[model samples]
Target: MPYLTTADGAEIFYKDWGTGQPIIFSHGWPLNSDAWDVEMKLAADNGFRAIAHDRRGHGRSTSTYTGNDMDTYAADLAALVDALNLTDIILVGHSTGGGEVVRFAAQHGAGRVVKIATAGAVPPVMVKSDTNPEGTPIEVFDSIRAGVLADRSQFYQDLSAQFFGTNREGSTISQGQRDQFWRQGMQVGLAAAYDCVKAFSETDFTEDLKALDVPIFIAQGADDQIVPIDDAAMKSINLVKNGTLKVYPGAPHGIAGSYQQELDKDLLEFWLS
Candidate 1:
């Protein structure tokens, strides 16, 4: 139940376990540090310190209505890292958290971070624009906003099916996974969560990806429905000076949960190598 107060006076709830090189986790949109439970345990058991923080508006953090954009999100992450005085960290982000990590690295991570890894992350950009033609259409995100404004609870519940790939043919999501996602979604502040949709979808990470000096590890699912590999991971790999790509065949957007074993193995290998 530890918390860190940001420069903006927002309290961020975080998890810190074990004692070794820190593997800091940033979770996706509308979810909290709880989403990284499996990865945190795995990293800790494997002889590393594991850390995860709820974003400014999600989980146990201060549910403020303002400062829900990428700049604020990245700044909040920077504040957490600074307050902890942690170094030699391996930053790992999933989905929207991926965007947060990259932005943090580009804007603040420099000397503190050793490497970076993202899975099914939203980077380079997720929403289509003049430059990002392959990105998901803006209308898709707009529709999401509409859904959130109309019926957020039902919207979050229904989105979990696709988010976890349960809606796919022959795919089955465990009740536990569904329940966890729903619970996390429901706990998020309505205004902050709604604002985060644009933060994750519209914020471009091209410069962030290009500015990264540390070795980059990109883990993505080939058939990811939420953030397609082609527009995201693929383009991201080419942008980084030192980058490696690993594609999980048929895996979904929630790879950290659905494909935890595979991701943990790969991440451990990268950390050791």
Candidate 2:
């Protein structure tokens, strides 16, 4: 129930706990702050202040249908930073949340950020434009957007399988895993999620990635179907002034959660280094 109101009077729900350099997490489309718990708790145990916010319409936050664009997302995040007066934050984002990290850093600068990282992020543009000719096709995003509008629940359900899933974990799929994913999506405002489809798919963040002045890392699942390593992580590495890429072979899009121990270890090393 804890939430902070943004500059535009939007009530942004967030979890701010623990102590040390703040680690702010931005989650992917349709999912909320709960997505970052494993990472947040680990950081907290290691003496870091970990925070995660539910994008306006998702999770327990107010489910307003407006302000679902990338700029608004960045602004909402900035408001949380300002409200907490967070200093020395390490911003970590996944999927669409990755784009949020990039846009937030570029718009607000790293006034209190020591590092920024993206995991299976959607950046450097997701859908191919003239400048990014190698990007994902327009029809791909259009089809996804259409699918969401057509049947929000079913589309999200199918997407959960496509996104969180990869055979690398195992050939067999677990019902618990599938149910957990479904629960996360069902906890949000359907309308907000529908609009977010386009925001995440089409938002361009080339300048944002390039302008990052702080240390940045990108961990991408090589076999991820949702956001290809080449389109998001590799491209980000090439753009950021000081950036590194970590490729997780045969991992799923939800590698951040599925492969927590491995990722946490890698991240801690990076943080201390």
Candidate 3:
């Protein structure tokens, strides 16, 4: 039970394994660090130090009613990095975790980070606006907020299907996978989960992406249902100074589970490169 207390008094639980160049993992919304077990194991087995934190208000961390926004999320992450005294780090994030990583790199990750990788990540921006016409509409996020308030348990269970693309024809996603997703989502605090919807959807990362000087690897599912590739990774690649884009054909938003092997191969290459 490794925990770090942030400036805002939120306790963040983290997992640290193996010992080499550090690879820190940030998970998506409504899910904990357990979501990164497979990848963390891979990184550890490959002679890298694997680290992942249950974001504040999610999983085993303190579920504070306040500071559920992206800025706080980044600050919590900075606290973890500082506590560990890690350098030359490889930061990997999935979905909302992607947003956290981007913001952290822009704000707190000056000389500490060496490389970054994001899969099924939400970045650049997710919500629609005049400047970003391809983004998802605000109504969609409002519906998500409504769903969270009305019946969150059922909402998470239903969202697991879309997150993994199990609702699609010929999809190979398993029942257990969907069940794990639901389980993870259910562990999130109601307040954090609710506020995070607005955080992930509305926070613009255009400037954050532009601030990165390290090599960035952006992986996206061609058929992501939650965060569309067109609005996220595709556009994110152009914003970073050094960026590589890898799109998984017919992959879903939960590429970490649905397309694990493919993502592992690509990430390994990027990390070693």
What is the lDDT, from 0 to 100, of the residue 165 in candidate 3?
90
Q: Give the alpha carbon lDDT tens digit for every residue of 1-273 in model 2.
A: 678988777788899879888889999988899988888888889888889999988988878788998999999998888888878878899998999988998998467777988888999888888888888898997787787678867887787777766334473456566676678888778678778878998898988887888999889877788997788888889989999889887677874454556777888777766
TM-score of 3: 0.98
Q: Tell me the number of clashing residue pairs for each predicted model.
A: 0, 0, 0
Candidate 3, 166-258: lDDT as tens digits = 889988888898888889888889999999999999999999999999999999889899999999998999999999899999899895454
How do the residues 1-273 of candidate 1 rate in per-residue lDDT, one tens digit apiece? 899988778999999999899999999987899999888898899999999999999999999989999999899888888888989989999999999999999989888888999999999899888888888998998898898789988898898888888887867668788778889988889888889999999999999999999999999988788998899999999999999999988788885454777888998899877
| Candidate achieving the largest TM-score | 3
Between prediction 1 and prediction 2, the one with superior lDDT is 1
lDDT per model, in order? 0.89, 0.83, 0.92
User: 220, model 3: CA deviation in Å?
Assistant: 0.3
> Model 1: how large is the Cα RMSD against the reference?
1.2
Off by over 4 Å in 2: 166-169, 256-258
